[model samples]
Target: MSNQTSVTEFLLLGVTDIQELNPILFVIFFTIYFVNITGNGAILMIVILASRLSFCGPNHVHHFFCDIKPLLDLACGNTELNLWLLNTVTGTIALTPFFLTFLSYFYIITYLFLKTHSCTMLHKALSTCASHFMVVILLYVPVLFTYIRPASGSSLDQDRIIAIMYSVVTPALNPLIYTLRNKEVRNALNRKVRRWL
Candidate 1:
């Protein structure tokens, strides 16, 4: 709690007060934990393996968590190195996709107005990229807000909400957005479900 004395580890007081609801909370969070790991892992795996996948260029992430910013705060030792590394790495990850998505749309719009463009292609690309952009914004904005600024004081509640937003909400939204906006993904999902049945 002082500049002279360094804290070794910070306690994550994550929803532990609700004694009766702990079981339910555990189940909910455990489910979300699995989903977050699997969903992001799946995306990373597909992106890594698919030679033709042409979104952003290749970058292997170095964070223990799905998003790296929060982990920086939890480090109680000398965080200067961790902070620098996290800022450089996660900042690039967060912003690069946003810029690429923006440029993609910029070209799409230019083509629509000035070149031989089909409304169908424009709509499809916009819808797909917009959904991705939305997810990226939702995931990264809070992280940037929480991590980029110097730590004033540690609030467990604030950290918990931000963690939930990035880990749980973002993962849940990915599949939902793709399923709802993408006809191909939806059809593929349906076919897979039917085959399983």
Candidate 2:
């Protein structure tokens, strides 16, 4: 809950200002989205930049989602505690998973190195993990930049752009990333395309 609040729904300004590109962007995103979902049942998701809004609003959110970071920009009163909470929660959430994921990769890679003598087999194993690692880095780097910092360090426009990377771009690219890396999936997809042709 916020103090000294104005009661109005926010006007959401989306990722870009150019009116002409919306349809083009929409179509591109839609195709990626369709492939992301259809190619597999599900691919990915994350939550960061979660913060309380303590705003006396003019009712404009300069982001597509009315995201907390943007709303925090509009917030009024003492927001230090809100910022602290945001940093703590976001840091804990972000780092824990990232730590676990990295640790898992380390052990897995170590096991592969120690247990396998075949250099070719090791290359194949590492290549398979590359797409997943790319997805992880794609997700975490933006998340870390966005939320794991003092509130003053965050820029709303940058936050919006980073949001696009993780939420829209990452998920959209996931099917391509995973499919291209996987020989079986790639062959199956190629076969399907050949049939259509």
Candidate 3:
């Protein structure tokens, strides 16, 4: 009988190699994970309620996708609990990653400054951070804006626009921003520019 294990390989850059930073990293990751799971678990209740409740009104979803708010709008009964659940989950999913990412950046900047004391290195680091943070801000801000407002105040048109921002714009920008930082990408762009010239 073979001792069967399906998992083949995995790679992990242990957050940080520094022993001193382990505790801080652990807490940050754990907090984000815990809060994220808890928020998602709350949605299960919403799902259960969706099945139990009688849906009223036109089946037409106002938004592009069947988002929680739009779905709840279709429900016959009062959706106070469902709305609250959606808001809470959205807030957690949106904010937790944003704040934690910033925290990581802060620590990285501090560490780099203290260790190297190189202005060029700091500038390079900040540029990378700025690009990443830009993406994070673009993605999270619109999502938070759409979800945090009072349900009554939610404009479907506005949401579709915001959805385009976070869903379409952010993702489209990610590869462009990150790839621009690569040496190979720079060379490729330079070649293209030279050919055009």
TM-scores of the candidates are 0.44, 0.65, 0.72
Task: Give per-residue CA lDDT, model 2, range 1-197, as digits (tens).
Answer: 66776545433226578988878878888897876574333111112222334457777988879665676668676666656666665686689889999999999899999999999999989987787899899889989988886776778778889999989998888778987876798899899999999
Give residue 28's lDDT in candidate 3 (0 to 100): 86
Best first by lDDT, ranked: 3, 2, 1
Residue-by-residue lDDT tens digits, candidate 3, 1-197: 99798666432335567889868877887897987687667878778877677776788888877777777778899788878877777777778777898899889878887897778888988888888888777777898898888988887788889988877888999889889989899999999999999
Which portions of model 1 miss their true places by more than 4 Å?
A: 1-85, 116-121, 182-197
Candidate with more favorable, higher TM-score: 1 or 2: 2
- Which 10 successive residues of model 3 have the least lDDT summed? 6-15
Pairs with steric clashes in candidate 2 = none
Candidate 2: list runs displaced more than 4 Å: 1-54, 184-197
For model 3 the local lDDT of residue 187 reads: 98
Which window of 10 residues has the lowest lDDT sum in candidate 2? 41-50
* Residue 27 in model 1: lDDT: 87
Task: Output the lDDT of residue 121, model 2.
Answer: 97
